[model samples]
Structures are given as C-alpha cells and as structure tokens.
Target: MEPIIHGILLAFGLILPLGVQNIFVFTQGVTQSNFIKALPAAITAAICDTLLIVLAILGLSLIVLQFDWLRIILVVAGILFLVYMGKVIWTSPAANNKETVALSMKKQILFALSVSLLNPHALLDTIGVIGTSAVKYSRQDQLLFTYACIVVSWFWFFGLATFGAVLKKVTIPQGVFLLFNKSSAVFIWGTAIYLLIGLWQGAY
Candidate 1:
C-alpha cells in the first residue's frame, strides 16, 4: 500500500512536467481534426515511456549513473534535437489555419517515439528516478511500483488528448492557439538550457 501511494504520487510528479512528450501529445490532441486522431500519438508516447521505465528497473539506470561521459553525451544530443524541434514548433504552418494538415497515424507514432525515447531528459528521469525508487523495493514491490508508473503514463496521455479535443469543441481562440505554439517552443528550449546547466553543475 505504501509503495502504491508513493508510486502514484511519484509518477504524477514526473509526468506532469511539460516536456517534449507531454507538449507534443497535447498539441496533437488540440490540433487534430478529431479527438480520436490524437490517440496514436498518446498511445505511442505511453509505450515508449513504458519501455524506458522497464529498462530503468532492469538496471540500465545504474549503468548510466556510473558513466559521467555517457550522461554528458546524452545531454548534448538532447539539446541539439530539442533546439531544432523548438524552431519547427514556432514556425509551424498551421498558425494561419485552424484546420491544419492532419498527420497520419504513422507519423504521429514516430514523432511520439522520437520525443519520448530520444529525449535525454525523459531517459534520465526514468533511469534515475524510477531506477532509484525500485532499489528500495522487494521484487514484488518493485513490480507493483512499475505497474503503477506505467498506468499513470497511459492515463495522463489519454487525458491530455481528451482535454485538447474538448477544447477544440469549445472553440479555442486563435490567439490562444498561437500562444500554445509559442509557449511550447519556449518550454522545449528552456528544458534544453536547463539540461545544459545541470550537466555543467554536475561536471564541476
């Protein structure tokens, strides 16, 4: 019971942060023609996150913690990727059209994978936080913890997609849409800078 409560709180704490995965999932939801259109992206994000969480529990987190060089490399790569993504978001062609081009399921899934799996921050959080938490649990408890975390990822993504769909039906203002895009860019860029600084601090 203790593990369950902690796991739920911990999972929500981690997922509530607006990183690339969360931002993209919500964006797809709000932008897609129908709420169901965003389903692939949300599910894909959950799957990728589950893989990371499982790996974290299986000891990949320990390996990452042991190697400072590896952490630095991941941070650098993430920074570059995020910068490019931020630019793309800011200049998205949908700015002038509420009925933006709808993405195919394949594209949404692929984008979800790139943001969830390839994002260094997501990887590190899984490896460090989830892994660390697992260490305190017995095998059975660990399984419970993992299960709780996975469930949160799935529900949170779906909820975000649903919220976006609901917002669309209510008719979001054009300025709000523009603001979301701009805010998303800023969030991504800010995350990159935060990761860089964290690396610098850790190195010293």
Candidate 2:
C-alpha cells in the first residue's frame, strides 16, 4: 500500500505539469471530430509512459544517465523534434472549422512517440525520481509500485483527452482555438530553446 500510494503521488506530480505531451493530446481531443478519433494520441502517450516506467524501474535510468554522449544526443534530438512540432502546431487549422482535419492515426502515433520519448527532462525525471524510488522496494512491491504509476499515466491522459472533447462541445469561438494553437506552438518553441541552452551549458 505504501508503494502504491507513493507511486501514485509521484506520477501525478510529474504528469500534472503542462508539457508538450499533454498539450498535443488535449489538442487532439479538441480538434478531432469525436472521442474515438482522439483516442490514438491518448493511447500512444499512455503506452509510451508505460514503457518508460517499466524501463526506469528495471534500471534503464541508471544506464542512460551514465553516458554524456547519449545524453547530448537525446537533448539534440529533442530540440530538433520540438522545433518541427512547433511549426506543425502553429500552422494547424482552426479547431472549429468543419473541414479542419485532425491528425491522422499514423501522425498521432508518431507525434505522441516524439513528445513522449524525445523530452530529456521527462526521461530524466522518470529515471531519476521513479527509478530511485523503486530502489527501496523489491520483487512484488516494486511491481506494484510500477503498475500504480502506469495506471495513473493511462488514466490521466485519457481524462485529459476527455476534458478537451468536453470543452470542444462548448461552442467556443474559432479564433480562440486558433490562438491556442499559436500559443501552444510558441510555448513548444520556447521549451526547445530552453533545452538547447541547457545543453550548451552542459546541464544535460
């Protein structure tokens, strides 16, 4: 029970922040025509999170943190991906347009993968925090803790998507969603720049 509680709280603390993964999933929910259409992004994100959590607990975190070259590569790739994602988001059509085509299933899965796996900060957090936390547990306790975190991740993303869909039903102005796209793009770009600076400073 302790492990379960700790896992839930830690996972929530990490995931509750507004990051690229969350934004993309929520926007898909808003832009897609229906809940089913929005699910690919959510599911992809969940699966990625599950993979990360399992790997972290199994000691991949320690392996990742050891090599400076590997860390640099991850940060570089993350920055490039964020730049491309920002451009894509900025040019996206208004959510309220009847003809606004949401991301295709393949694109959704790809985008979800990039946002989930490319972010070095998120990777470090999972590896550093969750990985370290798991060190205190063993066998069945470790499995329980890992499962708790994974479950929270799945539920949170689905809920985020659901909330976006609900908000879409509210008849907000088209321009508002357009502005959201633009703003989200700017935020993503800013994050990329921030990461680049960190890398330049050898913070990664």
- In model 1, pairs of residues that clash are none
Q: Model 1 misses residue 71 by how many Å?
A: 19
Q: Worst lDDT window (10 residues) for model 1? A: 93-102
Stretches > 4 Å off in candidate 1: 60-101, 169-204
The positional error of residue 137 in candidate 2, measured at the CA in angstroms, is 0.7
The candidate maximizing lDDT is 2
- Per-residue lDDT of 1-204 in model 1, one digit per residue for the tens? 866765666566556655567767877888898988899999999999899989887774455456657655655665676677668667753333234445899999988889888898688668755555555456677788889889988999999889877776455556765666676577666655655675667731
Candidate 2 per-residue lDDT over residues 153-204, each given as its tens digit: 9998999889878887455566865776677677666656766776778665
Residue 176 accuracy (lDDT) in model 2: 69
C-alpha RMSD of candidate 1: 7.8
TM-scores for candidates 1 onward, in order = 0.64, 0.64
- C-alpha lDDT of all candidate models, in order: 0.71, 0.75
